[model samples]
Target: MKPAPFDYHSPRTPEEAVGLLAELGEDAKAIAGGQSLVPMLALRLAVFEHLVDLGRVSGLRGIERRGDAVWVGASTTQTAILRSPDLAAAVPLLTRATPLIGHFQIRNRGTVGGSLAHADPAAEYPAVALALDARLEALSPRGARTLPAAGFFTGMWTTGLAEDEILTGVSFPVRGERSGHAVEEFARRGGDFAIAGAAVAVDLDGAGLIRRCGIALFGVGATPLRASAAEASVLGVKAADVDAAELGATALAEPASVPSDLHASGDYRRHIGAIMVTRAWRRALREALDA
Candidate 1:
């Protein structure tokens, strides 16, 4: 199927894009890379009267370090982020998860902002963004306001974005001396959507004990979830002493209730989610110790 007829606008600047969005209101769609939105358009799942393409936008497509955080422009491609020396050095978990998103072709065309706006629970970036405690910068007719990662996702395929808002960029803290990141997932095929996945980041004390740990799960709930129970299990424990098996069990002990899809049963998702969590946690712990 082809997309429904729509007016298209290529905005060279964010100000122009914001103005277009304000003019077009809810009928307008902001597209970058179009990896996600194009598919929606082709399927007619999204019916927009106006398509505001941001590929030409000058300020929304780069990576830079500001103060203590690494700021990624919303339009930055997954491929670009995966290869970024600054991102890898500052937030390796994003690098770890980027390759898991899809094939190289998809990564080359998928924008970080696009993925976040799409808000697919199974996508790799959202969980990493949440685990890293990233801040989303969005522009609107009302002016710009930052949204915390925790408050970004409202539900499946949904976000807090107002009709006239466009995500400008995201900012996240750089990894510290004893910090590490990890991601693990399983799929029927290499490039397929994950049945379940986990991204973990751990900060250790000089004594190698977990000072802080964040475990985020994907494809096991309506939206990607932070595994507070699993994180709590590892806190105060030395990395070497962490019982991964127990941690896995703990994550699945009262697994989140999720709707069963034909691709995988609810129980299977819970099981796989637990395994992914454990793997990510273990790898993060090792990385933290090595730091």
Candidate 2:
């Protein structure tokens, strides 16, 4: 079925988009790539009386290095991320994860902000954002406010974005020297959504000891989850000696947190999650040590 009949408004600027959302209130939905929302609308899983299109909003589309972090406009497409040399150099994890997203056709039209705002636990971008401590920027009638990645995702297909707020951009910090990042996931097919995945970043000290670590898991929880227990356990330890298998187990230590579905049992998903985490951890460790 087609989406419910709705009035469409194309906004050329972010201010106009925010104003439209504010005025339209509960009935309005802001759309960029529409890769996720359109399918939901088509299935009648979501309905909005008014659609605010941000395709013409130029302000929310670009990539640049601002100070020590990389600022990616909310409208930046996954295709753009794959093609940006600077982004790859500054945040290699993003490029490494891009291929694991849907096929090139979907990536061509899928915006980073759309994926994050939709907040599907199985998506790659959200987990990568979490692993990198990305900061999300939003605009509202109340002005601008930044949300940390840790708190940005609230639940399945939900986020901290208010009804009247529009996500403007995101900031991913560059940890600079001695840092390595890797992404590993299990999927039924090349472009299918991951059944379980892990994005890992490791920072090593001069003596090859772990300085910091970030591990984010997807497809095993309502929202993308950070492997805090595993992260804390490996800190300050010799990077090479940290057992990837044990680290993976620690990441999924809370078996109850993993969800079961027709595709895979919770126990099975947790087991796959552990393997993904282990592979990612080992790759990240190698890169960090070599750096």
Candidate 3:
């Protein structure tokens, strides 16, 4: 399927990109790596009169460390994050899930900001971002505004981005020395979209008691959700003392409404989500204790 005819503008700067989006308004769409948007355009799922290409935008394609947070440009590809030793050391959870994305070729072109803006509930990046309490930065005709990961996804394939807004980058809080990150997913085959998945990050005190824990689940909800109940269950407990099965059950407290497709039922997803949550919890505990 060929995309509908449209005017393409390759902007050299983010400011120019922003200006283009503002000027074109509702008829314009931003293209980063085109991993997601191109497919939609081909299928006519998305029809735009103008396409603003962000590939030539210079400053939107790198990584930087700012105090306690790591800022990743919206155009930074998944392949880049996977191989970045700096990102791995700064946020291991993201690195752990990078391999779970589409495939080597797709990851080579899929941009981090693009994924977040697309907000696919089952995508690996969204769950990891939620687990890390990342902040999304958007630029719009009205100016810049920062949004918390929790408030970013409003529904399936939806986000808080305004019509004239462009996501510039995302900032993930640095995990401290006592922190640990882990991820796990169940897919029909390698590189397939997960049937269920979980990402966990933990910060422990000197006494080995959990100081903070974040758990995010995917593939069972309209939006990736933080396993608040499960996280609460682990707080103040030593990593070795956590009960994985119990945490899993707690994580399923408010099961996200699942779509019943030919592949799996809502009940099946709930069960798988629970299992993935338990596995991720156990893995995070192991990493936390260096066991």
C-alpha TM-score for every candidate: 0.96, 0.98, 0.96
Q: Which tens-of-lDDT digit does each residue in 75-116 have in candidate 3?
A: 999999999999999988998999999889999999999999
Local accuracy by lDDT, each model: 0.88, 0.92, 0.88
Each model's backbone clash number: 0, 0, 0
Off by over 4 Å in 2: none
Report how far off residue 264 is in candidate 1 (Å). 0.2
Could you give candidate 2's per-residue lDDT for residues 188-256 as a string of tens digits? 899988999999998888888888899999999999999898899999998778999999999988545
Shift of residue 158 alpha carbon in model 2, Å = 0.8
lDDT value for model 3: 0.88
- Candidate 1's residue-wise lDDT over 1-291, tens digit each? 999999999989888899999998888888888988898899998899999998889889889999999999999999999999988999898888998887999999999999998999989889998898899999987888999998798899899998778899999889999998899999999989899988889999988888898888888887888877778877898888988878877876555496589999988998888888788878887887888
| Cα deviation of 44, candidate 2, in Å | 0.8
Q: How high a TM-score does candidate 3 get?
A: 0.96
